[model samples]
Every structure is written in structure tokens, then in C-alpha cells.
Target: MGRLFWKFFFFIWLAQLTTIAAVSTTFWLEHRAQEERLAQLGRNPPPSPELRPDGRPFPPGRFLRPGGPPRPGFPFVPVVPLVATLLASLIFAALLAWYFSKPIRNLRSAFEAVVNGDLAVRLGPVMGKRSDELADLGRNFDRMASHLSTLIDGQRRLLHDVSHELRSPLARLQAAIGLARQQPEKLESSLGRIERESERMDKLVGELLTLSRLEAGVMGAMDETISMDELVSDVVADARFEAEYIGRTVQYSGRGEALVKGNAELLHRALENVVRNALRHTPEGGMVALEVHLDASGNDVRFAVLDQGPGVPEKELNAIFEPFMRGESSQYNDGHGLGLAIARRVVEAHGGRIRAANRAGGGLCVEIVLPATCG
Candidate 1:
């Protein structure tokens, strides 16, 4: 009933009508030629009819018009059959047009709904079981809509979480200010509390900005060929200083020189985050192991961190990489829970993957794999 339907209908109908008209013309012309030949033969009668061997009269010509039974009609077209064919073609053309345009109409309507902010609108159910290009198109539209819905939902949730996380520190800062006003003797301690809260807020904001840039795919270019061995050694050295401060230790091992191409700063932060996270979870006096090596295939560099800590639940393994997702344990309740998330984003931006698995001997193992470069 739309313009597309009408266009399809008109073109299809015109094609059928033209074909019928051409065939009808050809039959009419052939009939006229036959009549002319018959009339010519009638003008010069075939000498007298030829006689048969048994003395019975025989038609001199196969089509002996003058002697044969009379011809039926003049214009020579079977009007009934021709009219029936035209009607049938019209019906078939209309049906075919409707069949093709119906799915398209559904697609248009679904797109309009999406434009109107209805991201949940879909076309798969409306498309039926058609096994054609249009059906494939409908499936693609459904996938796109689903992706957009997920992204928008994630953005809303991230905003809410950000607001919630900021509120806590802001409230703490206000309380610290109030306490300082009430107790001049404790002003120094109160100011230290405010300073600590301010620093935490600053760190949180910085991580958030980094995550946003990574999600937007605008974190500078990955054009440097970084030495993984050196990077791991540097991170381990820094982690050890902190680990020893808390009666914990970080042990590092390297197989060989593994090279990768990426932004060194981001990669360094990612490695440091993973290492520090393990350190934080491991019980004091327990050692966190950080190892770097090339995989068996030799095409990828792997960084594995193992800690003697309570492993994450099976269901929460993947969720731990989401921003502000912390473990239920009191130890995990300290930080803002953005380190692993930021690490994940940086690793993924550099064409790498990160995963966590429960260690066999009652611990958690975090691994990052990056494509190795020859440089």
C-alpha cells in the first residue's frame, strides 16, 4: 500500500501485460496470413476436386478452404482464454509485489520506531521464516538494535555508578571539614583526612577519564615497539617496594625478550594494575608471582599473575572487570575497584585479551596475552 509496493506492482503488471499483448499480436498476424492463403486458393479453385482411386471425391489441398468445414471466427484470437490469462497475470503480479514489499514495509516501521528512541524494536519475529536477502537484512537490523540498546544501558549504569562513587568521597570531605571546624586541636588530623579523600577522588576521576577515552577509541596511537621483559622487570621492582612495606613479597620471572607494539604508558599501567591487584588480595607474608613469557605458538606474549588469595566466584569472574565491581571480601572493599577495569580496557585497546581463572591450589590467576612483534 506504500509507494514501494505500488512501484513494484506497476512494473510487474506492465511486464506481464506487454508479454500478453505481443503474443496476441503474433497469433493475430499468423491467422491473417492463413486466411489470405485460403482466399487466394478459393479464387483459383483447385481445378475440380481430385478423384480418389476408389472413385470417391478427395480434397485437392490439405486445407481445402472452399470444400473444408467453415472457419470459426475472423480476428482469430481465443478471447476467453486471452482475457483469462490477462486477469491471472494481474492477480499474480499483485501477489508477487505484495510478497516482496511487505517485509520492506516492516523494516521501515521498525526503523522509525528506533529513531523514536525505541531501541528494543525488532524485525526478526515480523519477518517470518523467509529464506531470502530481506530476511538476512532483518536479522542484521535486530543485531544492530540489540548492540545499541546494550551500549546505552551500560552508559546509564556507568553514570549512576560514577555519581554514587563520587558522593561517598565528597561526603567524607565535607565531614572532615566540619570536624576540623569543631575541634581546633584535631585540625591537623582532620586536614589529613580531607587530603586523603581529595587524592582518592582525583585518582578516581583520572581512571574514569582514561576509561572514557579508551571506550571512545581515542587513547593515542599504538605505534611503539615495547620490550615486555624490561617493562615487567620495572613493574616488579616497583611492586616489590610496596609489597615489602606490607610484609608481602612480589616474585617475578621472565623467559626471554618478548616485544609488542602499543602505547608503552598504557601497557605499563595495565601490567602494574594486575600485579598490584594480586598483591592486594594475597595474605600478608604470602608471595605474588608475576611471570612473562612467549606462548608455545611464539606469536603472542603472555603475562600471568598468580596470587594466594580467595578466588573469585565463577559467576563474578567476568563481572570483576567492570568498573566499580569489587569482591565481597573486606580486603577488596578498600579501593574504588577501577584498576582491573582500566587494565582490561588498555589491554584490549592494544589488541590483547585478559582473563581470570581460579588457580588449582586455591588462588586466582590473571593472564594477559598480546600479539608479539618482531621489533
Candidate 2:
């Protein structure tokens, strides 16, 4: 039997049982007292009453019954009616149990399906249009399942992309090794190719590790107060050095000092990745600008990086933050396509949001918003 059925059955049964026991006990006690009184009457001799003036009995009908007084015993308790009532109660309890347990059973089944990897399972239709806690639970379960399914799908896609990415470099590395073995005289040149490929592989692995850690929330404890302005300046300075070498320009502009509490290393890396990405796309002699300022309320600090290169397509603005997701313009570049993804993870870990949008005039603008430390 279902839980509701048993619960109702037992409850109703116990109540009826208690009522019957009480009634039976009271009847038995009254019977026993009456029996004791009869025995005492049998042992005692009755004293004759004084004759009335008219020689008539004072209480004429009092002694008219056959035994001295009718012996007291159990009272009639309508056993048939009591039994019928109990049976009815039992039936009603069963019905109530079934009614309450039906929805719960449906929810359990849906949960089981989800546990078995059936993400499409939902309980909304099963729950029907009832306004109760059970119905609310069904709705919440569907929402949770939908979210979990999305995350799982994203992870699967990420794995596929990662495998595809790893294969290309591996093939090149193997070919370079084969060439070195075949041409011993040009081993040095072949080894140079091998070294470059190895370095590329190492960088890719390191970035993957970093991304994993960020996503897993494995960063070390953050206890440092970071000056956002200074951090941005440092990243911009490094980008500027590289930009100057390539005939491009990097500039930093800020209003007030923006301070926040977080891991300085992670914040720096996040900013550096964004700046470097912009520098990579910005054409030679173009400018990549970095701006930092606090919001009007001073509760949040905003960092904006704008590049003078071809911006991403309007439709793919959000896709760029996903792992291995590259825009049309970036597809032809020599990047590993994980820079923006890592930057996003880092910023999110620090309780911030990063977004990219196309600048009005030209190029792409990336923004980072972090909660500022209160003065």
C-alpha cells in the first residue's frame, strides 16, 4: 500500500480502537459493581417495615420485581451500529490516503527519471492545475532540471571542442618529429618546429588548467584589497610595451581610485587577458584604450577596454565568452580561443560580470564590472 493509504488506515483504525476499548471497559466495570451488590444482598436478612395505618405498602411497586432489585450489568451499546461506523471511517481514511499520495507518487517518478539522466522529464503536466505545495514543488523541479540539462549540454560541447583543438597541435608535433627522423642533416630546423609546437601545447594545457580551477572555484582564499586603478595601469603598461613593439598604442584613462577585495593575481590576469585580446585584434598604428571608473553610487567599479579592430558580429556577442567559441574575425587568428573564456571565469569568481559589445564607431568594447570596496 502507498504511504498515504497506510497512514490514513492506521490513524482511523487507532481512533476507532481506542473508542471501542473505552466503552467496553466502562461496561465491564459497571457489571462488576452490580454483581458485588447482588452478592451482598443475598447475605443480609431484610428487616420488616412498619405497617401503614391502612395496611398498604408505602412504596407499592418498589418490591414488586422478581429478585430484590434487578441485578446491574453491562448496558446495551448498539454493537451493530458501532461496527458500521468504524467500517465507514476505515473506508474514508483509505480514500484520503490515496488522494494525498497520488501527486507525491508522480513527483517521485519524475525525480527517478531525472536521476537516470532523463533531463527532459517534467512534472508540470502530471501535477495538473492544483494550487498547493506539491504543485509548486513540481514547477521548481522542472526549472531545476532544465538548468541542469543546459549545463550538461554545455560541458559536452566543451569537451568535444577541447578534443578537436588538441588534435591539430598533436598532428603537427608528430609530423615535425617524423621530418626530423627522416632528415638528420636538418634536424636542428625540425627540432625548432617541435619546440614551438611543444610550447604551444604547454600554453594550451596551462590555460585549460586555469579555466578548470576557476570554474571549480578552487582559487586560493582572497584576503587582499586591490586598487582597481593601479591594477589596470599595470596591465595597460604591459600591453603598451607589447603594442609599441608591434607599432600599436595602448592607453589607460581613469577618474577615481577604484578599490575592491579579491585575489590580486586573479584580477590582474583577468584584466591582462582582455587587454591582450584587444591588442591582438587592433591593427598596427591603432589604439587600444583601457578605462576604469566607479559608478555614480561608488558601489561598483567599471573597467572598459576598447580596440580599433573589426568587432565581433552582433549575433555572436555572448558566444565569445564560452570556451573555444570564436567569432568570425577571430577564427582566422592564431589564438587558442580561450582568452575571453578564462577572463570571464576569473571575473565571475571575483563577483564581477564581463561583457563584450561592438563600439559605435568601430572595433569591440569589453567591459568588466566589480563591486567596489566601501570607503
Candidate 3:
């Protein structure tokens, strides 16, 4: 038998044994008292009852003739009834034990399966229809398992992508080095190519480190009050300078002072990444707009970045926030694909949400919503 069976057997058996022992002790003590009383009365205690003429012992007592009080002695205890009651109690305890142990056994088995690397293992259906705490435990286990499975899978994919992205730049750098060795006259040009690739790799690695820290919930410090208006203005001014190089313009429009409590450096980086991403996608002569506003209830600060470029597919809007995920339009863009992902993690660390959607006429709109501070 399993652990449940042994546990139930021992506990139930002990309880039944206690009950039988108490009953037996009570009966035995009464019998001993009666024996003591008889001994005290001596050998010829009392005369035998008188017999009737018909030889029926005067029928003991009759309705018409009242009989004397019953003799002071131990009452008879029925061994058969006692044995029957004990037997019935044992059976009931065994059934009760099984009822409780069955669910616990199933949970243990499910936990074992999870330990054995079966992330898909669930206990809901196995538990059937039950409205107890054990059932809730089972459901929670399934949810935890599901979440772990997702995280593991995502990590695997990220590793694969990182390796793939690194290979292309490394290969180009190697080829450039080979050319420089073959042609000494073109060494300067080859060195330029090598430097660019090295810088690209450096940027990729830096972004990856930032993403990892954000994912690990390291948001620096939150001891400062950030001005949302100034933050957006700084990001837009910097992006606009960069956008001008590609014939694109960055515009900023909003009203009122929106303040929040968070790390100023992190908030600035998060908003800057978003604004720069919009500027990168907007085509030459196109416009990228940044808007900061408070919701109607004034409880939330909202920042929206709208880009006049080919928006992503509807189904992929949410997926773009995942690490190293890029849309079709972004395939030709020169980016490490971790900007939005890092932005998302930073926002989440500050108890905020970021989402992307296609604008009405065209282009894409990315929105960030944060809880506003009272002061």
C-alpha cells in the first residue's frame, strides 16, 4: 500500500482501539465490584427464590403482586453487541480514512510528475468535481506549472535568437579581416568595417544586459519624483535631432504637468527607447508624434508615440514586445530588436502597462500608461 493507506490504517486503528479499551475497562471494573460484594456477604449470602406450584420459580414478579427491589450486583454486559459495535466502527474509520487519503495521494503523484520534468501535467481533471481546499491546491499547481513552462520555453527561444544574431556580424568581421590580410593597400577600409561590426556587437551586448536586469526587477532606485512633461520633451528633442538626419520630423504635443514616483533614469530610458524606435521606422519626410497626457480621472499618466510608418500585423502587435521579436516592416531596419522589450520590462517594474496598436488611417501607435502621483 501507499503512504495514504498506511497513515489511514494506523490512525483509524488507534482510535478504534482506544474506544474498545475504554468500554472493556468500564465493564471489567463493574464485574470486579460485584465479586467483592459477594465475598463480603460470606458463603450463605441469601436464600434461593421460592418455586411456584407449577415449578416456574413464582414467575419472579407479577403485575398484581409487587416484587422486591433488584439485588445489588454487576449487570450483564453483552460481548456479542460490543464486538459488533467495534467491528462497525473499524469499518467506518477505514472508509473515512480512504476518503481523505485519496485526494492527497493524487496530489503527491502530480507533484512527482512535475519534478520529473512534465510541465504539462495538470491536476484539475484528475481531481474531478470537488469544492474543497485540496481542489484549490490542485488548480494552483496547474497554474504554476503552466507559467514555468512558458518561461522555460521563452528562455530557450531567446538563446537561439541570440546565437543566430551574433553569427552574422561575427562572420562579416572575419571576412573583413581576411580581406585586409590579402590586400595590404585596402587595410584602412577593412579596419573601418571591423570597427563598425565591433561596435554593433557591443551595442547588442549592452542592450541584452539591460534587458536581463529589467527582467530581474532591478529598477535602480525610486526615491525621486519624475516630471512626465519634461521627460517627454527631452526624449522628443533628442529623437528629433536624430530624425532630421533621415529627413523625418519628431513632434511633441501635450498639456498639464504629469508627475509620477519612480526612478528618473529608468523612466527616461524607457521613454527614450520608445521614441527612438518610432523615429527609426518613420520614412523620410514622415512625421513621428509624441503625446503625454493624463486620463479623464487624472489617476493615470498616458504617453502615446505615433509613427507614420507601415504598422505591424494585427496579430503581431503584442508579440513585438517579446525579446528579439521584430515585425515584417522592421526586418530591414538596423536595430537589435530589444528596445521595445526593455521598455516593456521597465514599465512593468514601475507598475505600468505598455501596448501597441495600429493608428486609424495608417502607421502604429504605442501607448504607455502609468499610475500618477498625487503631488
Candidate with the larger TM-score of 2 and 3: 3
Clashes of 1: 0
lDDT of each: 0.89, 0.84, 0.85
| Model 3 root mean square deviation, Cα atoms | 4.2
- Candidates ranked by TM-score, best first? 1, 3, 2
lDDT string for model 3 (1-375, tens) is 577777887798788889888988988797777566656656332255545457775444211123332333335668898889878887888787877788888888888988998888888998899888988988998899999999999999999989988998999999999999999999999999999999999999999999998888776888678899988888878898899887999888997899999988888989998988888788889999988899999999999999998888998999989988887656445787899999999889888999999998889999999999976
- The best candidate by lDDT is 1
Residue pairs in candidate 1 whose N, alpha carbon or C atoms collide under 3 angstroms: none
Residue 279 displacement (Å), model 3 = 1.7
Worst 10 residues of 1 by lDDT: 64-73
Q: Candidate 1: list runs displaced more than 4 Å.
A: 29-73, 328-330
On lDDT, the stronger of 1 and 3 is 1
Task: List model 1 lDDT by residue over 1-375, tens digit each.
Answer: 899988999999999999998998998788778778767766544445655578887633334343453333335458899889989998999999999999999999999999999999999998889989999999999999999999998889889989999999999999999999999999999999999999999999998998888888987878999999888988999999999998899888899889999999999999999988998899989999988999988999999999999989888899889888887653667777889999999999888999999999988999999999999
Q: What TM-score would each prediction reach against the true structure?
A: 0.89, 0.78, 0.86
Error at 113, model 1, angstroms: 2.4
Question: For all candidates, what are the clash counts?
Answer: 0, 0, 0
Best by TM-score: 1
